[model samples]
Target chain A: MTPSLEAVGLTKRFNSFTALDHLNLKVEGSKCVGFLGPNGAGKTTTLKMFTDLIFPSEGESFINGISVQQDRKRALAVCGDLIETPEIYPSLTPREALEMSGALRGMRPEEIRSRSAAVLEEVKMTEWTDQKVGRFSKGMKQRVNIAAALLSDPEVVILDEPSTGLDPRGMAEVRSIVRGLKKGHRLIFMSSHILSEVVDVCDDVALLDRGKLLFADTLANVSQRLGGNTRSVEAEFAAPVEDSVLANEIGSLPEVASWSRADARRVTLQVKGGPAEQARLLRQLASLSMGLISFRESRSALEEVYLREISVGDA
Target chain B: MSADVAPARAGSLPIADGAIGTVPGTIAQAITLSRYQLRDYLRSRRFVLMIAIVVAVGTILTTLVAYYRPVGLIDNANNLYGSLWGGGAAFLILFAGIIFGGDAIAGEFQNKTGYFLMGLPLRRVTVYAGKYLAVLVASVVSILLFLAIVVGNAVFYLGVGAVGDLGQLFESFALALLYLLALMGFVFLFSSMFKTSLYAVLVVAVLFLFGFSIIQSVVLALTGTEPWFLLSYVNQIIAYPLTGVPEHVARATIGRATITNYAPTYFEGIAVMLGYFFLTTIGGLLLFEREEFT
Candidate 1:
């Protein structure tokens, strides 16, 4: 059976303010889908509903094809979630906390002990397993939270902004752990406002704004379709080229939509079309005696698409 | 991804295999939750504070009894037990309920721990029942410690043979336990009512400590009617088995008007306590069930 998560017409309202409006999304199989949105884009609200931490005002959430609102226990039996930085009891060690989690899930003592060690190791919290959570840092607690979510080896894991409050190194470590999770047969639904983080770890990206979904698709497809038929590339030269000569040569190429010089040796261009067009432009550049050293597509293509979509959504 | 597809049956889907086992029933889940929650309570600072309060109260009473050596209290076991256990047990129960249960549910929201527990395959009712059970057990332990101190004093002052009527003492103890349950039910209701632990703890503490007593007094003074509905009025029954039931109503005329004092009968007290236990416990569970972890 395939792991799946679905939100059918899911809507949530706090008084007059709608946190999530008519959300309908479904993810299947073993993949990591990033739920991307701005500060108040209802990302955490949606994940809370899916985890049964908050009830939906309209529609329903389902886990593995079981209705979350109707049969929460059975629906979440094979699911694990870390919603909004849930704190463990200060008095309890990670081992004790995970033991409680495992017991609640009906895991036997032997199973709990072995799995506790395995998940603690997976989160790189093996040394702190017996230490009280009160003494751990935010990143350590977050790792313990993640380890608890993985204690049951759940097929579907829901994480709400796992790296929201972490430092740079902490964020990198969390992303690495999330990347490692993809190796298993699991459907990971993670929410984040960090665009670059989503680009780094997510296979599919679902963009939401002001309680509405703007688009949902694979990262490649989103970039290709919404990239406005153009891609940005950067070219580095071994030596400085005359401005007039560089402009005249770039203007002669039909594939070059726009160009800008970062310095005497580096030039950025918005090249028209796909890899073939980029290849033709690079060939044309190499043909000129401009001492070209290296050329690569800039990594901000997704950022451009995201900004455009979000602006369009706001408009 | 398709949103229109029908939901798959849970049985048809791949259940978590290997180390993961089937989820337990509600009772087992509640018990498991109770075990962990009890562990937390045991290690908490409030538990130590409660024990200290009990010991301090016991120490004060012990010193006064030993120094004064009151003929009435030292000569008879019933008077000693009634004055010591009956008089102090209610306050101990109130403190115990407030210390252990005042934030049992509200702390989950304020501290954001529910975000972790509620995501699992456990029901709201299970969480409520489990926390209530933990509070009950912890409160009982404190109450029993106070009782031991009372019995210790009785043995010291009146000798082993004069340790009061064991039957009446046990009956009073049973009544005290009943009162503890009712008070905890009320504490839990307040805990479920608010999202902030401070508010829940304060409201419960004030109401149990003096709020209800004041209201009971006001009602009796103004209406000249029985305050039988009040838990404070009914709590007198915890000691009445040892001290003998008092007159249901006593009226005295000062200069202009007559003031009335009302006492709850054994039947009325038991009925009121049972009503509070059922109504407040069920009401708290319902509130917890509907509350969102927002």
Candidate 2:
């Protein structure tokens, strides 16, 4: 069965200040959707609504096709969430914390026992399983927090900036741990203002700003939507290559709208069609043996998209 | 934990929400949560510290009564019990409740742990009830342990027979438990109403310790009436049972006019205390439910 999350004209107001305004979006399971926006964009607010931490001024949130506002318990049964930078009780060990979470989620004692071990290992926190969380670092606490969130093996996992306050190593470790949660085709809804964080973990992105959904689609589709019927890709190579010779070799491909040498080892090309033709061109370019290091879309596409959408909303 | 967000690694199938067995009922959830709460308190240093204080106080009281036999205080074990537990019982009940329940809901919000809890499948009322139940059980245990110290002293001084009537002690013990529940509910109400634990603790301390008594005295002096609604006024019924059966509405002549002084009977005390239990417990839950994690 398909699990889904939807926000229907959802609005939230903190008295005179409106946090979210008639936000409408729906997402299905089996995809890692990034809830992306800048600070004060209400990404966190929207996530809170989905979990019913705060009631909305208007509208409703549905999870797994059940109304969260009307029946939060049933709606949230399939969800596991880590919102903001919530800390566990300092006195509680990782084992106890996960056990409590698992027990509340209705897992059997045997299941809690087994999954407690499993999730701790998943987050690489087995060593600190019995250690009081008080002495643990922020990163350590965060890992334990995530472990608790996954205790139920929820179909939909929600995290707000899973690596927000961690050091670089901690962030990398968190990202790596998040990568390991791909078993059983669970839907991971992660929110972050950090573009790199979203880009690193999300398969699709829902962009919100000032509590409004500006865009929602796969990266490729977003490029198509905002790149304005065009795709600009940058191909990077390992060593310096003759620009003219490189351009001349694949310059005549029908999908190549235009090609320019970014530098001795890089070429910026405006391409057309979609992933199919792009793959075909990649094969042709790789065959040239011009030290073709890596080929991917240019950042300008999303940079342009962010600026366009946010600026329009600002207007 | 989030699944890999990179496009290449995301899952390609949707797992159903009810794939797992159904979430347990709310009551079951509350009990499961309470076990953790109890364990937390049991393991905490405060529990040990509180116990040590009670033992020390009991030892001093026991020694003073047995050897010194101060003035007219200890005519018998019954008198000794009444003197030891009288006003001191109110403080015990109030202190025990505050120590456990004062930070209950506020700590969750202050520390942002409520975000983690509210995100779960259990309802808000389940969490509130769980915390309250945990505090109630723990407070009852703490208060009883203190009473045991006093009882040991009574047995040592006046022998097992002098420890007062077992039935009365039991009745007193029952009243103490009721007081525990009522006071805990009051603490929980403050806990839920406030956003910070420090404020919750302070408000509870000030109100229960001195604020209520002062207000009750003032109300009685001015209105020529007993403050029947004030918990501290009616809470005396616990120790009053140790001395005599209370007249529900005691009357006395003061100054020029005959003023009435009201003291709750067993049932009146139960009614007032249980009213506190239900009213504040429900009030706290409502506040807890409406609160935003942000």
Candidate 3:
């Protein structure tokens, strides 16, 4: 099946500064693809290019099958976007802005009303419909923007930093709302300095660093591909064992990937293999009178991967 | 243009008739876009308030002037010319220019909202034209209301008298609108060029209010030539009955030499204004087309 959105060798430059460089991306229809990066890593720039907010200085992007650079309007017909800092005429209430957006997108007036009401309810912003968006808090404005985006029932939705300035509950609500959209439309979500949010929601993720795509794959696939001989365990002592003894116990485990005295009373171990192997190693440590405090798999989180890749680019 | 660029059907869905299909027609899109813009303008309370005040002031001033028949050559000249300078024409141009033109692109950039609006299924040109037409319509509406008040006063006070100068009045009013349009076009151009509303307003005001006048005066004084053909110098060309007015020594005015010497003919003035209007608008849009909004 044809991809819903695709970018090949996309590059953008602002005078002397290269904002994006030789980057490639693709999102299969009906999937939520997370874009992960650091500040100035080109995530926003790439999203802008895809939405036709900014032209790619090099390469091309397609929405559905139409080239965004060539037939921008046709390509945009199936797409809706909410970039950073949602804008509306300050005096217009949320409902008014949504109505105008709906009309412009060719929705019938009735469709506009129903769709606005539906999306407002979905975003939990129904009560704020009459309030001017200018008076809204950032999160409220974002919800209004999201409502406008959904008015046309677009086939693809692109959100940049979608959860910025939202409360925890608001963030979770937005996440679920985006997840709900996955069955009917593809989603391209860009976030810098927010890994866990994307990790929880995206089917696939592309990690970027200094305007280049470092890795793009499913979360599990990326973890497997970057597999390392490392694991972590936390062990407690019934009577407070000495660090020396704990270290010695940790050193004795044959599967111990690495060991160190985490503190005077506990030892942390890095072990080879997966969580199962790590669990067995923890049990062995328990036999040595080192009662376990807690244990978790020791590996690179998305944050670590993001930092490591960006630092590498810096070098 | 490929064969695929045919007009769209109802609901704007693509037809797979083996023939090349274009996007929806420009007319439909233009209508929708313009409607959206008009709604925005009307919904803006500040703009609505400003319009109401402008219209009320215009009507009040016209009624009082026509009733009193304030007599003086300049007063009579102002009756012919005051509408141009004082009848909210300049004020409307400046005010509408800011509301409609200043925020055209600058606010989009400053707010970082270009991504949302520009991402829609509309060409950049369509968006620009729709906005321009909407502003033009709004400006025209307000100014026309002001005109209606003036004409009403003329009928009431002048006793429906034959002025024998209806053609001149038409010429003056038409020229005023053209001048305002040209002014708005440059303001739009400046708005597109800058990334802040204040900068756009400041630049346009300087060009029209000060820069154009200063340069015109310098040229006239230095070259001993007629420079009223210049935009700022030709205010009287389209909006006044004054063929001559002695320079006012009590009130300091710049560009005296320029206004006295070389004002453009009505046709020449119209050509210049139209040229500026069309060229600046197209140029502004073209520059905007290639710009990357961050």
Better of 1 and 2 by TM-score: 1
Candidate order by decreasing DockQ: 1, 2, 3
Model 3 lDDT, residue A43, Cα: 85
Q: What TM-scores do the predictions have?
A: 0.93, 0.85, 0.84
State candidate 1's TM-score: 0.93
Model 3, span B106-171: residue lDDT tens: 766787556556767778777777777777777777666766665555555454551443555666
Candidate 3 residues A1-315, lDDT tens each? 333667777899989999888776666645777888878889888888887888888887766656788878777777778877667767678888887676666677787788889999999999999987879998898888888877777767778888888999998998888878876634445454567777777777788777888877776665565348354555555566665665565676788766776566655666777667866776776666556565554334555466667777788
Off by over 4 Å in 2: A226-300, B1-19, B71-75, B246-262
Candidate 1 lDDT, A1-315, residue by residue in tens = 678899888999999999999888899889999998889999999998998888999988888877889878888998989998888888899999999999999998999999999989877899998898978888888989998998998889999999866789878988998899899898999998787888888998888899988778888887677446788799998998778877788765899988888888888888888889999998989988688899998756667777888888878
Q: Candidate 3 at residue A207, lDDT?
A: 81
Give the clashing residue pairs of candidate 1, or none: none
- Candidate 2 docking band: acceptable
Best candidate, TM-score-wise? 1
- Tens-digit per-residue lDDT, B1-294, candidate 1: 553434434443444442278899999999988888888888889999999999999999888889999999988888999999988999899999989998999999999989888989988998998899899999998989998998898888778876545778899999999999999899999999999989999998888778988998788677768888989879999999889999888888999887777778999999999999999999999999999998
Residue ranges of candidate 1 with Cα displaced over 4 Å: A235-246, A261-267, A275-297, B3-19, B162-165, B253-257
The DockQ figures for the candidates are: 0.54, 0.29, 0.27
Interface RMSD of 3: 9.1
Worst 10 residues of 3 chain B by lDDT: B1-10
Clashes of each: 0, 3, 8
